[model samples]
Target: MTTLKSGDKAPDFEGVNQDGKKVGLQDFSGKKLILYFYPKDNTPGCTAESCNLNDNYNAWLEKGYEVLGVSPDSVESHRKFKEKFNLEFDLLADTEKEILQAYGAWGEKNMYGKKYMGVLRTTFVIDENGVIEDVFKKVKTKDHTNQILKSLNI
Candidate 1:
C-alpha cells in the first residue's frame, strides 16, 4: 500500500480509547487531529512522548487539536499505560493492526542490524477538513510534541 502523504485523506479507524470509549476519525471530524503511531506502550520513548503530550494537553486543546495515539496493544494495556502515566489524551488500541496498516504505520523496521515488521513511529497532523496537513515519519521520541507544535505554527 502507498504510504499516506500530505493532502492524502487520513484513514478512518474504529479504536477503543483508554476510557473504553470508541473513537473514530468521524468523531473528530471538523477538528484538527494529531494522530500518532508508536511501537509499544509503557516503553521509555513511548512514555516520554505520551507524557510530553499530556503535559501540553491543555495547550493543544486551546489550539483546537485533539491528540490521539495508536498502538498494536489491547484496550486493557492502553488503560494501564494511560493510568500509569496519567495521560489525559486518548490512546487508541489498534490490536488488529488494521489502522496501522491503513495509515501506513505498519512496516519493516530496523534495530541493531535486524529488520522486522513493526509499527513505524509516525505522526500525522490532519487538518480540520480531514485531509492530512503534515506527516512526520520515524519520529524522535524526545521533544517530538514540541517539534509538532512548532511545525503546526501553534
Candidate 2:
C-alpha cells in the first residue's frame, strides 16, 4: 500500500501499549496526536529520541497534543524501555509492522554496511480531525523533539 501523506486520513489501528492496554486511533480523536515511529526500543538513538520527547512532554501536553510512540517491538520490550527511561507516553507495540508499513516507516535500512528491513524513524503530527498535518522523515534522534516542537510552534 502507498504510504499516507500530509493531509491524508491517518490509518486507525488497534494495538497493545507499553502498559498492555488496548488502544486505537479513535481513542485519540478530537486531540492532536503526535505519532512517532522508531526503529527499535532501548537502542542508543531510539533512547535519546524517546527521552527527548519525554523531557519535553509537559510542553507538548500544554499545546494539547497526545504523544504515542510506535515500534516493531513486543509489548514486553516496550514495557522495559518505558520503565527504564520513565517514558510518560504510550509506546504502541507494532510487532506485526502493520502500522509501520501504513505510515511508510518500514523499509530498507543500512547499518555496518549491511542492508536489512527496518523502520525508517518518522513522526506524524495529526490534527484533532485525524488528518495528518505534518510529516518528519528520517528523523535525527538528537534534535528530533526540538524539530517537532518548532514545527508545532509550541
Candidate 3:
C-alpha cells in the first residue's frame, strides 16, 4: 500500500525512542538502516519480528546496519517491551504516526472481516545515502532476518 520503492529517496522521519531520546533518519547517514513499522508492541507477530531482529542485532551492526522499529505505542510501552524481550536496538515511539504516514506504513487494514486504519507491517532497507534499497511488505516475522538476507542476497 506504500508508494515508496527501491532506489527512491527515503522519506525523513523523527521520533523518540524507548529511552525518550530523539532519533531520526539523519542520525544514520553513513550506515544502512532497517527501519521497520509494526502494528503493536506485544502482539505475536510484532514480538516475533522484533525478537528475530534482536537475535541478529550484532550481525547487522557488524555489517554497518542499524535496526530501528517504529510503532504508535507510547515510550513506556516500548520500554517494557524492550526489557521483556531484551532487545538492544531502539524502538521509536511514533504516537503521532507522522513517520508512519510519510513512509506509507499506515493505511487501511483488514482483520476478522472488518476493515480499519492501522499500521502496516513493513520494512524499508535504506542505504547509506538515504535511498531505499528495498521494501518488504510481506515480512516473515519468525525469520525476518533471514528473509531480508535472502531477499537482498546479502
Candidate 4:
C-alpha cells in the first residue's frame, strides 16, 4: 500500500520508457499525469489493468491527462508488452526499482502465503503542478479508468 495521499507532492521520478527514452516528472510539467505502478509486464492482472487504461486512453487524453505505466521490467520486456497490447501510452521500465520505491509501490507482497518484495499495484493521480490529487491503493483492474475519472470528477 502507498503512503502517499491526496495533496501530497508527488515524488519525482526519472526512468526509461519502452522506447529507451528518458522520462522524468518534469517532462509532464503543467499536465495531469496518471502514474500507475504494477507488478510485472504481460501478466494477467497487469494486462487487464493496462488494457483498461489503453481502451480509455483517448478519454483520458481528452480530459487533459496523460498515462504512464511503470514496473520492474526491462526495456525490452516493456517494449514487447506495449507492442503486443497496442498500448497507446508510454510504459516506463523500472528494472532498478528506484522509481517504484520512491512512489512506495515496491514492497513486500504475500501470494499463496509466500512473502516476497515486489511492485504493488498502485495508481497516483498527479495534478498539473505535481501535487498528488489522489492515490488508489486498492485499484480495481477492470474499472480503473472509471475510478480515476470519478476521482477527478471528469
lDDT of 4 by residue, 43-143 (tens): 89999999999999998899899999999999999999999999999999998899998899999989999999988899999999999999998999989
Candidate 1 residue-wise lDDT, 71-138, digit = tens:
99889999999888888888999989999999989998789999999988889999998999999995
For all predicted structures, in order, the TM-scores are 0.95, 0.94, 0.97, 0.96
User: For each candidate, how many residue pairs have backbone atoms clashing (under 3 Å)?
Assistant: 0, 0, 0, 0
Candidate 3: the clashing residue pairs are: none
Computed on alpha carbons, the lDDT of every model, listed in order, comes to 0.89, 0.89, 0.95, 0.93
For residues 80-123, what per-residue lDDT tens digits would candidate 2 score against the true structure? 99999989999999999988898888988898999998888889
| Model 3: lDDT of residue 130 | 99
User: In model 4, where do residues sit more than 4 Å from their true spots?
Assistant: none
Cα TM-score of candidate 4: 0.96
- Candidate 1 residues lying further than 4 Å off, grouped into runs, are none
Candidate achieving higher lDDT, 1 or 4: 4
Q: By lDDT, highest first, what's the ranking? A: 3, 4, 2, 1
TM-score of 1: 0.95
Model 4, residue 72: distance off in Å is 0.3
